[model samples]
Target: MDFGCDPGEWTDAWSATGISHHWALGTGHCIAELKALADLMDVEFVEVDPA
Candidate 1:
């Protein structure tokens, strides 16, 4: 996922998919982490409104 803020804490992209996912994990992993999940999935020919 997009752990851009915590560069040191992020794992490689390959594992987090098809393995499992976490949302609202804890105080340590808060809103930004949830926001990161949005970029985790990409669909071809699909456009999503930011709103």
Candidate 2:
């Protein structure tokens, strides 16, 4: 779980969506909120060090 800015949005629950690994994906989620949720789920959010 990388704590980085990945572009994604939540689609409909009724409809099934296929996974795509396109380079031009759209971003619509709040990173901070996602981090908090991940923490509650006991998931490690690791950020890559640019150094």
Candidate 3:
């Protein structure tokens, strides 16, 4: 969650795709809109602090 803005597009793309580290790792999810996808995949969505 300590990502720098060197390539701001990285964050922008992730946001547009509704993806997060937790979501991709299958450990948890932080994006609210992506929760449905997680539910469909039987994944847990854990809220996280904004970086």
**Which candidate wins on lDDT?**
3
Q: Write the per-residue lDDT of candidate 3 for residues 1-51, one digit (tens) a residue.
A: 445554587657667885655535322343555678778988776655544
TM-score (C-alpha) between model 3 and the true structure: 0.33
lDDT of 1 by residue, 1-51 (tens): 355546454545534565456322334345455456556754222232323
Model 3: clashing residue pairs? none
Instruction: Work out the TM-score per prediction.
Output: 0.22, 0.32, 0.33
Which candidate comes out best when scored by TM-score? 3
Provide the global lDDT of candidate 1 against the true structure: 0.44
Q: Model 1 clash pairs? A: none
TM-score of model 1 relative to the true fold?
0.22
Query: Compared with the true structure, what per-residue lDDT tens digits does model 2 show for residues 1-51?
Result: 332334232333212455444212223355567568669988765543433
Clashes of 2: 0
Model 2 residue 36 lDDT?
Answer: 80
> Any residue pairs clashing in model 2, and if so which?
none
Give stretches of model 3 more than 4 Å off. 1-30
